[model samples]
Target: MFEKFRKKSVVSESSQLETLREVLRRNPEDNDLAKVFPQVMPLSAVSSAWPGPIERLGDLPFGVSWALADPQNYFRYVSWDMSRKWEASGTNWRGLAMENLTELSRRYPYAGSKKGADGRPFVLSLLNEDSMGPSRLLVPGLFQDLFGDDYIVAIPERTCGVAYRNGLVGEEALLANDLIDGCFKVGTEPMSNERFDPKRFWVL
Candidate 1:
């Protein structure tokens, strides 16, 4: 009788997990997840258990210097209006829109928009880190919402290899490199005298 009870408990738990996964898969933008599972908010729980290399402040210098020195490779022109903001911020390029994971999934379910030269499938996630943890739900949810039709679901990894075959870098490689060298420049102030001035340059 005890053995039967244990089996039933295991099945129930598995079913619950699957149900949660399905919900997240269908609704990546459900902010209510935090209410349902408060511990998953702020991403601290996931970050703590992340199985990636520890981030160090020293790494910032390399990424910052590289970006500052090579404006062409690092910067991309988004639009005339956005260029002004980028100039004001003293940055020429924008990193992948991490905050727009849900939108990206909604628009490009299989891969990123076809209008671009780089036809890579845009990666989406909630947790900013590239590691195995609870916060990892953000990525899987984004993937399911966006590319569920084309990609396979894999926990922890949160990316589908077959769906990303044409991408420039695999999800793991992107995570590893991004963790090692990527920097988030949101809401940072531009240094005095370092702001870009488009008015100073004329289009020939």
Candidate 2:
């Protein structure tokens, strides 16, 4: 009787975990998972408890992960099982993510260009409501379309990004670095403080 009870308890626990969350993908416009976006995260940012492994992005210490955004919630991470299923259904997940990212950028365009105290110009996208600011680095030609070509970006936190034209010199470069470091130190969802040249990657 004791062994039977233990087996029954194990089965019950397994069933409970499986039923804990029922992720449904009824359609592209489904409230459960309509908007899927690509997000860059440090290798250590994710907890081991997560269901999927983050795909490493080149040789960088970051990885490419998927996020699901809906109207009711801020956003949530997508596990490997969910992403694989989405892809197997003939929906190009990466392409869809890029499309959603483009739309998100359109909705919240970067604020007007601002100049540092030293007279160097830069652009900032620091929206507290939008947590995908760092993910902007994954979208090629995005900065070029808005601020022209040859630009570098610093995404210190998930909700903030600082960008400036390439070939910065002297104090201007120092200032950019300082800005990135400062944001990174204080950011809640700290991603990276390194500057990135979007031209290096052919994001599509």
Candidate 3:
């Protein structure tokens, strides 16, 4: 019975993987590279088989990777094979990715400024309706306009990123740390507990 159950599990896994591959397969026009965007994720969340290279975010354990969004199927990582093809076609994938990401940010209407218990101001985007919470961290200029200088940023959960003004003090600072720790403790697809330096991301 044990062997039978193990075999069944393996088969189920294989079927699911195949279904994902099928969903990723696209025709020429459908393979528009302009749809590609940069995604921020913890190193642990990435698998060995994940296509394309993972660019480290400065000294942080998190990394920036590329993904293409399929309106019907959500999104998929850009495969090495596809990367090569795009390069051969003289496509600057990174530039394309950034352009798409910036445009997507314009469409994200869920984020706003909020005050902590101690009346400290911060900008928070939780569970972005577009489902690109952590990715928003890449848009430093946009958030910086709202947050100004002397602020810290955190991407605790996959769908949550916050930028707190005044560096790390008062109730807002404590709240940011608590949110990061709580997300990690609860295994809520946590990204990072460490405050992200947007400068590091700019180097990419």
Best-fitting candidate, scored by TM-score: 3
Per-residue error for 49 in candidate 3, Å, reads 3.1
lDDT of 1 by residue, 98-174 (tens): 22333433444332221223543344322222111212223334344434434322112211111221233455446
* lDDT on C-alpha atoms for all candidate structures: 0.26, 0.62, 0.64
Pairs clashing in candidate 1?
Answer: 75-92, 75-93, 76-93
TM-scores across all candidates? 0.20, 0.69, 0.75
- Candidate 1 global TM-score: 0.20
Q: For model 3, state the Cα shift of residue 79 in Å.
A: 1.0
Q: Tens digit of lDDT per residue, candidate 2, span 110-129?
A: 64355666554565544425
- Best-to-worst order by lDDT is 3, 2, 1
How far does residue 148 in candidate 1 sit from its true spot (Å)? 3.0
For candidate 2, list the clashing residue pairs, or say none.
none
RMSD of each: 22.6, 11.4, 7.2
Model 2 scores a TM of 0.69
The predicted structure with the larger TM-score, 1 or 2, is 2
lDDT, residue 174, model 2: 71
Stretches > 4 Å off in candidate 3: 1-29, 45-48, 71-73, 109-112, 116-120
